[model samples]
Target: MNENEAGERQIDIMVCGAGYVGLATAVAIKQARPSLDVVLADAAPDGVWKKDGRASAIAAAACAMLQRLGVWDELEEGAQPITEMIVTDSRASDPIRPVYLTFSGEVEPGQPFAHMLMNRDLNGALRRRCDELGIEIHQGTPIAGLDRSGACAVATAKDNRRFSARLVIAADGARSRLRDWAGIRTVSWQYGQSGIVCTVAHERPHNGRAEEHFLPAGPFATLPLPGNRSSIVWTERTADAERLVNSDPFLFETELETRFGRHLGAITVESKPRAWPLGLTLARAFVTHRLALAGDAAHGIHPIAGQGLNMGFKDVAALAEVIVEADRLGLDFGQEDVLEDYQRWRRFDTVRMGATTDILNRLFSNDIAPIRLIRDIGLGIVDRMPGLKRDFIAQAAGKGGPMPRLLRGEAI
Candidate 1:
């Protein structure tokens, strides 16, 4: 409506792809700086996601991030806690090694490691917060074009609408078109495996225990959900995964049971099985002139560690804090000084997590005799060493890290 603002220069921040990171980033920034305008656009309908088909394991760290965003207090009782984790090398008929890790603590005096939440439920909660914060959302609109200069970045959506901003973050996803438009090259590779994710209802309760059964082909995991249901992440060879996903429910569940064993007792397919291709992707650089990459736009890693989403959340937290600080300091949020700081803060952590997950996948995705012996002993050693176990537990709880204030459940 104002020609001077658009024609001369404006400093609005546009977040493309209002999925997890996009929405999270938008709301985080709004909460941090109420005066700054944070806009999000996506190519889907805007709605509350109470019961979406997919579920993601939200780590304690991620939960803390949400709490800081003022979204956690609203999540329903659907967020299930994982009181225990059981890992086993499923090479032989019996477990070559079985390791159990337990944890019970709170963030303040009533917080607990993490919770199992439906993707929709979490998104729904964020959406409500966005509503309360007056965050602008442009849905059913995909960015179709872009124009950038030293002072401003412009985006053209599918609706033929033009939006301009001082900073534009690409949270679009692995096949991020925005990253491509920015001429940012990425290193990407397939894991030669695929993870089949689904929720199953079992005869016996999982007792809040999550299980990861590493076999020769790949890793199969069962994370506890509400009731007697468990979320399964079964990794398989690419070709086999395609076949299994295409197979009927009965056959698919049969194959799943074969690999899962009877640990959870008479398991029944409760939700439709889904297939996610395993892969690794790292953007050559995280920022361009006035643009920055967030979430999958920056990196994509194997979900074996359940750190993929958590990593994206970290990027969101860091980038939001950095930009908000720059605004308060009256500095150009997209200037090299700000962008460089973000790259430095995120690059190391992103690279380490990617490498760590890759190595873990390779090491445990097999049944090699030597590796089996070594890892089994390693597990037993950690099990016996309570101090070491506590460290591991804390790490898994997302306690020990370069945490932002929001991640620490503090107001930003």
Candidate 2:
């Protein structure tokens, strides 16, 4: 990076939002094309990332990308592979919730489809890799405004720091200020529900199995973590979710136990329960002029399929590949034409996943007998179809469609 006479920092690319997608994008590009100057600026205060206690399921393809970037080695010790998964649809009060679908096996020999790792661990590993690559991260440096009329997009920070770059990538999350400043509109809606996230320790081992119980409110997922701990994503109506998270400890645990079941033996809450409103936000246009959107800035889907983070990783992989390849060919990587390739590659898959999740959440988050019976029958049919199950596993593993080089475990 260089500074002009006006003291404005100039670079090849400026990535807003230092979360997983932004960090990975910077790392992947710099690792492949070291000549390009890349830097990250986040609105969050320094060290705030260390406080996130939530965990995410990293798909096989995402793991491959992280390994390629040389960050997975640091996270492997704490990662817990999800070897099996079962799905059931029933009311929370049902004494016996019959399993409607089951999924097992790996995408490749000995490689589970996904693994769970705490958000902090993932963020720390990526930040370390960024450090090793000489990438500068400016915490608490929120982009106050963006000017895209000039040859380079100039971002003005809240503190009046100016950053000029040929391309500006917004991974600033669902409610991205940069996205709006760029005049990008979004198609979105709320599900009238909020997801309650927390960690719990169980007396018995999970044996690497994950479970998703579709209750009247929404899907309650128990994702395995290292040892006898598991991360929970329980959805409830907005008011009830707010009450549950702020309720007394005893009351909260009692409500949690009602849906957690006895299969895991007694359970103890290990973290404070937090609630996040569930919604879908898809940007109307992913790229315009010198600016582009990635990760949650591009699309935010329901977490019913556990593919939220994985989708962001896919965006990083695709965007990085497109930028790297364009640069390799001696072309302007920030040109709208070049960025359109990325939009074309990711838009369909993203829309499909969004629609699928929306439909699933709507179909299962109810107790209507007819809808319940139809979905149960569909799940049962899917369970019995080996080929279909394999296809679903492949998709979840992030290996179904034409994969980007990084996702395929190859160098850009």
TM-score of each: 0.93, 0.98
Off by over 4 Å in 1: 1-11, 47-51, 92-97, 100-110
Residues 92-149, candidate 1: write the lDDT tens digits: 3663445543344333345557788889888888878988999888877789977886
For 57-147, candidate 2 gives per-residue lDDT tens digits of 9999999999999998889999999999999999888999999999994877799999999999999999889999999889887888899
TM-score of 1: 0.93
lDDT measured at residue 205 in model 1 versus the true structure, 0 to 100: 82
Superposed by TM-score, candidate 2 places the C-alpha of residue 57 at a distance from the truth, in angstroms, of 0.3
lDDT of 1 at 95: 39
The whole-model lDDT of each prediction reads 0.80, 0.93
RMSD per model, one decimal = 2.3, 1.0
